[model samples]
Target: MYFSGLVSFLIKYNHLLLLLLSLEFMALSLYYGLFLFLSMMDYEFFFSMLFLVLSVSEGVLGLGILVMMVRSHGNDYLMSFSFLW
Candidate 1:
């Protein structure tokens, strides 16, 4: 997705808030696109619905984590974290 590419670029450049926003945009686009393809068989439609739910939940969780990171660290650049050392 184009939003995913933007997210990667933002992450690479240490733009944390922008990365989270782009991730949300990507997930929203995925939900809309998947919803339009519901003309398939029953089983396939069910699987697509399941994937849509998972993606929405994943995006929400990611945003929550990012908010916590910003609160704890005063910023959210992934590269700024050094706990690995």
Candidate 2:
């Protein structure tokens, strides 16, 4: 529910900052779900650590995207994005 709310907010806002924040929230929610499932299964903490590393990697990637978006558009908006051939 919380993550879905974040998704809705991102869709309505549709800007780079919101996109990055939403991605973090999404990753956190996934980590929570994974932790719960692994705990129930008696899995090791190593899986949670792996997820934490993944979340950090996701933050880096999302920030990279935001930087590129700023460089290309000089502002945050969906319309400013374009594809290259």
Candidate 3:
């Protein structure tokens, strides 16, 4: 699942929304793997909780950027931005 998300991210770079979604997908897969590892190890779940919190915050930040991009540029296409040069 993680690899699939990465492939999507690499192949779908035309749109900011698609990139963010792929990133979130990758993060979710990592969270699931971490949770399983912790469970099998009989370790505390605090780390997993922290990881989830961080991933959610990261997703929120990405969405906020997406919103700003859409509002200013009128679309989510990455190529819509003008070059600084």
The best candidate by lDDT is: 3
lDDT of 3 by residue, 3-82 (tens): 99999999999998999999999999999999999999999999999999999999999999889888988998777688
Best to worst by TM-score, what's the order? Answer: 3, 2, 1
CA error at residue 36 for candidate 1, angstroms? 2.2
Q: Least accurate stretch of 10 residues (summed lDDT) in model 1?
A: 35-44
**Which wins on TM-score, candidate 2 or candidate 3?**
3
Pairs with steric clashes in candidate 2: none
TM-score of 2: 0.72
- Cα-based lDDT for every prediction: 0.70, 0.77, 0.92
**Per-model TM-score on C-alpha atoms:** 0.60, 0.72, 0.94
> Candidate 3: which pairs clash?
none
**What lDDT is reached at residue 35 by model 2?**
84
- Cα displacement (angstroms), candidate 3, residue 62, comes to 0.6
Stretches of candidate 3 above 4 Å error?
A: 83-85
Off by over 4 Å in 1: 1-12, 39-45
Per-candidate clashes, comma-separated: 0, 0, 0
Which candidate, 1 or 3, has the higher lDDT? 3
